[model samples]
Target: MRRTQLLAGSALLLIAAPVSAETLKDALLKAYNTNPTLTAERANVRAIDENVPIARADGRPALNLTGGYSEALLQGPGTNSINSPDRRTNADTQLTVPIFTGGAVRNSIRAAETRVDAGRFGLRGAESDLFTAVVGAYMDVIRDEAIVGLNTQNVRVLDVNLQASNDRFQVGDLTRTDVAQSQARLALARAQLQTAQARLISSRENYIRLVGDEPGVLDTPPPVPGTPAGVDQAVEVALQDNPSLLAAQRSRDATAFDINVARASRSPRVGVVLGAGYFNYLGSLGAGSGVDVGSQSGTTGTAGLSLTLPLFQGGRPAAQIRQAQARRSQSIEQVTEAERAVVANTRAAYAVWKSSEQVIASAETAVSANRLSLEGVRAENSVGNRTILDILNAEQELLNSQVTLVTARRDSYVARFALQAAMGRAEADDLGLEGGALYNPVTNYDRVKNRWSDRGRDVDPQPVATRTNESKPQGSEVTRPLDPILDTPVDRDAVNAPSKRP
Candidate 1:
């Protein structure tokens, strides 16, 4: 069994270590450079780019060409007829471009541009989320590394204590109760060590899977910006940057355009046409009229416009307009609600972080106090001045304080990220960190979409941002190794740069 386990461990290590393998940054950058989601979103955004051309085409001249042949024969006619079966063929071409459409074309093009902006915001949001995910995974690896070290130190300390107690008992210097107490303490510590080790292993595995490879020492990011002057300011920034809100606004605008399009449908549409033709006359009432004469040709051109007015349609257009208005209203409500939600989250995270910051400091001090008390009790126990139970109680207090400090620190780190997220400001740039090759969906979109589109570039300038729900596993996010906020001051301007939201 021992041999089997040893072999398995060695195999895992071998798999983790690759020869000539890429650096962690290299690997992540490569994957980011070609991630399918980014590419997919970029294409979606660019598809929005075509609306301008389509709308403009509606206002441009339309030209068409037509040609046809016809043949007729009359048998046993009594007299030279003015009209007999006439063989005729006509070739014609006409061009008609709509010179105007009240507001349909302009409104449609404007709507498309607005939709593009929404996509840009959405893409920016997704970019921010990707950065957050990568950083969180990186942080998880760091946290696990720290915990493994801490657990190792704890197990060693417990082992030494147990050995010391055993030595004392061998000489009949320590009571059976003292020996038993040391053994029990050592066992508890060992259990904790095992649990910690398991967690570290699991965490490392999860990070590797998400990141696509084993992690190494990551370049530490600069500290986060301090809390803004107030929560309202933070909320304002979030409201402006949050892609979800922007998308909602875009939705409302598009619906207004839809109203224009629907209203225009009730109006008449006009255009122009030109043509040329050839004809053969088979019979004529005049005495000189010839039968089966050579075909004569004639050409003509004319400007004409065909209009379709919706006088009535069972109230369908009215119903459509009402539906569009309702959608616009719904979108407005969504934006308002989204803004409120962000504000509430920002406040909540701020409160929790502030409280945890103080608690972490206090807990560290408690751990120190408990450690000293446990030492004093142990010293007294050696001299038969303190009871074994009392020493054991002191040890428990020290352990509890350490555990509390660990939890508090973790909570503080998590809260900071949550706050940043609430503010719609969590991004790769926010970390002042960079990966090798960035995956840029826009560039990829241009390369793929430009091939068939004349104005592909104009279509999809918006960044794609995806919205997530509460169903996301919050605990999956990794805690940073240390609090940058507590360690170093961050630049406020750098932190609050204006642009698309993540």
Candidate 2:
């Protein structure tokens, strides 16, 4: 007996231990950790970082090493070759640093910087997308599970109605048709339960696909936060805070830099070059042998500045300038379109969220009313004043109302997050992801801009400079240093932006 008790206790413990629960916070963290798509986005961001250094390289000098070995035929008819017989080795090394490239160097650097900024904004946009996907998947599973619970309760209610019908029929209080009606309702309820179970299974699979593991069971969702003040408030938040919009803005900035880069190609480029050389030869002059540099100097060094003024380049520079200008125009339109989209989504999501709260409240009341009706009908049936059909109808109504309530509660919760997401304020921080990474506008931006500001540092960022509103301007041009993660827009300078604090 003691052994039996121990086995039963162990089995119960196992069942209890497996009943794990998950919440939205848990879902987002897991998605961030395990989702391959999000990881791919991060890799893309890192790849863009290299562009900053590439642009910076343009502003610096380029060094090359030249080496050659050759054997020469004697110009003379006899053993006397012009200098040496098939045995000469020459080596030269040159360092060419660009002192000036019209403004090409600076322009290229700016374009690169803008590209880095675009990439960072892209990172933020990616974060927002992943945030929504995780939340939606989480909500899908929770909603279906609630539906399953409601279906099970519906089956139970049908069972009670079926029992009542049989009791009434035996005493002639209910007819054959009434009994059949109750039986049919029970069958239908079972069918619905099966359907709800199937949906729940699919939902669970989708959740696990994104989160990398089965959530098993979800805890009850919390209530949505109170509504925002109005449509304007939601729209304002979305425009001010959305990463997507910032991405578009950065794209615009990049195009603007492109215009400058194209224009700079037309100016003169100046550079300095330093060279060193060595020449030696070893040969047999017919019967006479000689080993030496042959009276020629073995070491030499030269240094000078080279200026390359673009007189003409087949109209390519002009074409590039036109292309960049067109892109700038397109970027402007895209930014305008993106802003409109933000406002529309914010308003739509907020409307749904507010309406759901009211709907859920009303549904709760309806469920209570239906439950009261079911109880009253059962009492009437016992006294022969109500038929089995009436009681079964009231029970069905109660079940439906309960199911509606569950849906309302779920939708309301989902809409709250949706509104936040739509307004661009929805973040991992808002969802309480613990110890989340802060926005690193500087780290990503310096990947591009830091090269211009700090040339002495041994380590350099990427080819493209990442700029943000957070960067402060240097002068007439927006020679500001910026952090890449910043999304907030500011108008510190039109021609030159300054003091960017992300």
Candidate 3:
């Protein structure tokens, strides 16, 4: 039973070597360059780009060319007939242009443009999610690697202790029971070391899946940038910049235009129609007629303005309007929900990050105290004031404390990344990933917005500019009314509050 306690308390305790190693930025860059999910979202944004041209086409002119040919036969009891066999051909060219639709086309274009804006924000949200995932996976690999090392050392140390106990038992200086205890502890340590190694392997596999490559000798991640000064400040920044909330806000704006589109159905539609046609008829004249007719041909042209007033449509337009209004309301509620979720998540992450700092500090102090205790316990054992078991227990305590410290450090780093994500800053550009590509939805939107051809651009314009979320420093300051009320200087104490029970 005590051996079980020993094994449980003495988990893996490892210190990573300080050397030239793979940085967190490198892993992040790898994920950013090749993540399939990010690539798919970028494609989704481009698909949204088509909505603009489709809406614009509604207000453009359309023309058609038509032609037909026919042959006919007529017979009348072997006598000359006025109606005889004949062949004819006809052709026409017609054009129609929309003059007005009570602003339907214009509003539709507005709605589509708004959706495109929302889609851009959606893409940004996806980017933040991807980066966050990469950060977690990278940390897991490092943590597991450290655990495996500690376990390996534990097994080795236990084996040496078991050998010493066996020699003492042979000399009758230690009991057989003591030797058995050492053997049991050694065996358990070996088993745990195996388990730790397996977990490391699993963590490496997950790292490969997310980061697009196996992890090398990974270095400890550097401190994340732009941590909020306080939890309240984090909430404020998130309300302003969280991509999900921004996306929801833009979605509400898009639905506002839907109301106009639905209402436009009740108004008059005006258009212009122009048509020209040519016809030819050929036959032999078999009766006495006023005019000779070997062949006849004529051309005709017509132009008119068309108007369609919807006097009534079985209340369909009114029903559509109601539906649009309901959707707009739904969008408004979604924005509110998004804001709430962002605030809750930001506060939660801030609390965790703030508390992890204290946990790490306490664990470090515990490790130091435990180390000193172990040294004194070993000195006592050499003077016959302590037993071999006492020394082993002291060492186990030291190792356990070291394990706790490592865990606390890992949690602190992960929480910091989480805090960054919550504040809408865990993006490649914000993280300063080097030599990675950033997908700019605006560049793709601008490329295809005005395209008139069915076949798209032969070559897309390359996005040469760097993408970032920060506002330009040189721009004239425009302050929102709520900013003065909500903005506060960074409070380190608020940002680093005590941890709470879950």
Candidate 4:
């Protein structure tokens, strides 16, 4: 008996324990660490870093080796033609060191390095865009869940109203029309509940797709920090710090370097060439011939300076220079385009965030007034001064306002996050993601930019992102309950008291 009592007490404790909810920070951290799009962008930046080493190779020393062996198939016809050696083998090694290439190699290396910087900025922009999407998905689930709860509660309340209307009709106190009206409203509320549940399921699926796991109970997200004071401030900050704009500017600078690289092609190049050779007659030299050959093996070496001047390049160099100049011009215009887009996006996000704030305030007031109106309608119906339809309409108005309030809160939060993202302040570092050190693209660029070893290579890549295929299917469960204020009861005497109308 004591064991049974202890087991029962343990079960009770388990039931009372609260489940630890997932926070916005936790979700953002998961996305940051495992998102596939962001992972691919990091790889692309690493690839760009390799271009620097490739350009440097053009100015580095190169060595080559060649070897050949032959057994005379048929001795070249001719006597006194001192038949050539019946067997022969030879080997040669050469080294070429570039001394000058105008400025082609130098300017090409500079362009590649500049592009690496641009790629890193592009990676930052991708990170910020990903975080914004995650935030929107998170808020979507919260809003839809609340809407489902509200609709569920409405269905239950309407069902109760329908039963009461039926009771009144049986006693002849209410007409059959009154009972039918409650029945119709109840049906509509159930339909709305189904719609709300469907929307919630979609939101949960999207959350799983991004977060890499089925969402458990998600806590209310904390307010986004560091919102701009106004649209002008937001645009000012974005122009200075936005990743997209910075990347465009860097790309333009790199293109300017490309023009120099193209022009360098027209200049003279100089280099040094050194070579060594060995030959072996394989004991067959002068065999059976009256000629004596001393020592059938020999070695030789040579070194000299080489120069190349392009007298004419078939007009290729001129065309290349022109092409590069055109590209630079395009890049200049693109920088301006990026600036325009940043200003427009920042201002729009700011306006939406501000408007959402106003809508939230108005919705809160509407919810309060509608709740009081619902209570008054119920009191009037109890005294035969209001029809059943009046109560149904009041309930619906209250539900509308409640739903509006939920949606406005969601919009406000998401807009604020969007605003921050537009201003280049919504990356992992800005959010202070806690589990690990943030990925530093510069670490990779620095590692590979000057690499000289041919045998050097990074380890093979394994997937960093988690997969969600095996997780349980998402359901339409509501994580948050409807507001309790909706249930506040008003005194019948106060509701029925005559109003002092002006």
Candidate 5:
């Protein structure tokens, strides 16, 4: 009974050990939460968020404190010796506030806010890139693993063939040349298996670097996110949602505000200053000469307004305004370029995705046909109607077809992901991956935008009412349902049709 309990306990331990197969969603969530590159970009966004406060500081009040003490010896010409002591002490406080800057400060603040918005969009672009990269790595690992399996099976089959060929040669059914051919093919198969193993190792290392852990048996990837009906609709969606284009648009808006700021540099500035002071003179009477001092103290206060107009600045303000205008023009060109690129890329990805589906279907058919041919050839060889070389060749053809089918399937999935990414719909919510907290760039921005304290770091922003003034794409033309082909798994039996001839 004790031995039985020990065996049962061992079985329970084996079952309880954590060795769950990782999924594509797990890899994506791992990358999203732990990737150092993404984390660095998040920090960069937070740093950009500080610009708003820095700009607002130009329009806010500033206070300063001042204090000083000095001791001196005075000597004059009256019995004239160096024996006069004098001391002075003073303390002062001053406050200066900007009343106006001809709208420069306000425009600067606006520009900073726009830039912050641009940074947020930039972060979104980084996220898309990161998720895309994780997808690529995850798929690479899966692809290499399948290739390794195929290679291993190929080697095993070749080994068995080599042994059979040697036995046939001994029995006088096969010649020595045929046995040599089998041996050579087995050597090549083993080499191929080694190559596949190396590739699998490399892919696993990359997975570790990107996902922060070694890979496990990964589940098959699910269908990708938001799908468009056609290439035109995909391009349209990209134009509306692509983060890079949105960033450029915000940047253009910011540069326009910058032009206003540069022009404001030539306008008049108004400010108010308030000062209060306490002055004290310590008593030091005349000693050997005619040096005299008396104890005295007084407090004084002043308040005044000032204005300054820029009359001449060596044409600097004009040059600045011109520079700002040029930058605005450059940003506009950037937005145009970004739009063009998005349209071209979206169209290309959509075409690739559509083509991959066709490739998969055709490759599956080829595999099925080749499999039937292989079986028929083997049956003929069993009756001495076909040679061993013919059987080997048929097997090779079937293996090649299988490999091609696997590659086509992998490409189909990858292209679908690329299509989703090109349309800016490859985010966590769209993919239904709810593993961890989604890092919202706007959360950090809103948290730091109006911060006034310097004690602790800013807390993550709580959910607030949506801003109605937020910019949005206007008048979208296409709103079709997600394409069923891209959004649902293809029919497996159709993709893996049985050998009809067999």
Candidate 6:
């Protein structure tokens, strides 16, 4: 019984222990596997892939069957039964194979294939965008948590100072004004802590929304890899590798093909038509006829080449060709626009990343100097050379600098990630996510591009992304215990003591 009790106690301890810290890569991997937006884009690309086979089907053979039965209720008085076939039944089957479509079928297939490539590049763009958002949210939480910790610590320190002020006043060593100043500072510190905690909660909620899980103790993220050394280099890489630009270029190529498909409307179409039919007279052909019909059934077969030329289409073909040409022009302009945007974004991200580094360096210096200044002011106050307000001001400056430092670090990291994304290097593969193979749009495209089966289908889709509502409610987990001394009332008699010079 004692051994059983010991075992249960050990299990309870293990259950209560905190889980290991979650790393940035872990959060990114989860978002990659479960983000709804990325998943939907992937599905859209797969749908686009089907267009290839759909276009090809237009050039393939088509077979159709028809059957019918009919009976004449009344015939003309002079009509012959053999010629009219009073009761009749017929069945027919026809097969038509396209011999040539004046390049319409060929270009349509090419356009569809090009669009599939464009969709794949678009998927890559979506992936990069999602990873950038996750990186921002992750950094925001870390920054807010640090700010909350700083404010909480400030509150505790102020509470202790307030108590000391009350003690000095009771001994007639400090004035009422000094104690009031300390109390006011402590109140402000508490308010700041509350605000910081609120911001922290908001950041955590955002993190959960994107990452699909409550954030645990997050490990500090490593520096973003593959950062370009300069803006020019970054822009050059972006112009070459940016998914948005590449997708736009592909779309332009597809539109060129679209123009060819439309111009084919004026060209002649040729095909082979083969048909077979059967007819039954229902035994009514020889009834009451002077001549006896040898048989009441017959079969017919025919095969021939079919041709169609567009003589005049009420100017519709010309209008369609012009429309396609205009669309190709628009696509060409869009490609240029995408390129310009990529260059601007790459340059801007690089600038921000560099500036953030400078801000971090400056903030660190300010924090260190402020800390030394606060210490000196406190030492001077101990010798009655500095006023209480001077020490208070020093502490406030130090807190401000420390908060700035924390914020700058977070900004720097997020900006670096943005830069990497702009340069087309922040995707899942670029990040080296583990635990599974990366989702390749080509896999789905290759599987469906040449498919000929009519009944093939994927399994019904279940929800891949996790819902946030099912997770625990977000709260400020970075809160610190309030100083117990803050709750105790100051001795009223000490507060009522007359002011005295130190």
Which ranges of candidate 6 are over 4 A from the true structure?
A: 1-19, 74-79, 479-502
Query: Can you write out model 5's per-residue Cα lDDT over 364-450, one digit (the tens) per residue?
Result: 777677767766765665556666677678657766766776677777787778778778887666666786667787887777777
Which model scores highest in TM-score? 4
Report how far off residue 17 is in candidate 5 (Å).
14
Name the best candidate (by lDDT).
4
Please give me the total number of clashing residue pairs in predicted model 3. Answer: 0
Q: What residue runs in model 2 are displaced by over 4 Å at the alpha carbon?
A: 1-20, 72-80, 83-85, 163-173, 222-227, 284-293, 383-386, 435-502
Candidate 1 residue spans exceeding 4 A from truth: 1-39, 64-94, 163-191, 205-213, 240-243, 274-290, 296-301, 386-400, 428-502
lDDT, candidate 1, 58-99, per-residue tens: 776655667776654654756444444345566667677675
Global lDDT scores for all candidate models: 0.58, 0.67, 0.72, 0.84, 0.72, 0.82
Better of 1 and 2 by TM-score: 2
Error of 6 at 48 (Å): 0.8
Of the pair 3 and 6, which is ahead by TM-score? 6
lDDT tens digits by residue: candidate 2, 1-502: 3234333432332222123566667777877655767667666776677677778787776667888877665455555543445576778999988887766667777777677777777777776778777777777776666566556555655665566567656866557998799899899999998888787777666666677766665555566454679878878878888878887888888887778888988988787889999976654333244444255336888988888878989999999999999999999999999888888878887887789889988987887777667767666555556666786687677767767776776677777777777766566556667646744555754545456443444456333222223423211111111111111111111101111222
Task: Candidate 3: give the clashing pairs.
Answer: none
Please provide, for model 3 over 1-502, each residue's C-alpha lDDT reduced to its tens digit, 9 standing for 90 to 100.
3343333333323223446577888888877776777777788888898899999988999888999987656555754434553566889999999999998999999999999989988988888888888888887776666566555556656665676676666766667877777777778777877777777777676677677666766776888777677899988888888888999999999998999999999999999999999987654333344555555768999999999999989999999999999999999999999999998888887777778788878767776777677667655554556666775676576657666666666777877877777778887668766673566778877888887876555557454222322322221111111111111111112111222312
**Between the candidate structures 1 and 3, which one is better when assessed by lDDT?**
3
The per-prediction tally of clashing pairs is 13, 33, 0, 0, 0, 0
Q: State every prediction's TM-score relative to the real structure.
A: 0.69, 0.78, 0.81, 0.90, 0.81, 0.88
Ranking the candidates on TM-score from highest down gives 4, 6, 5, 3, 2, 1
Q: Residue 368, candidate 2: how far off, in angstroms?
A: 0.9
Colliding pairs, model 4: none
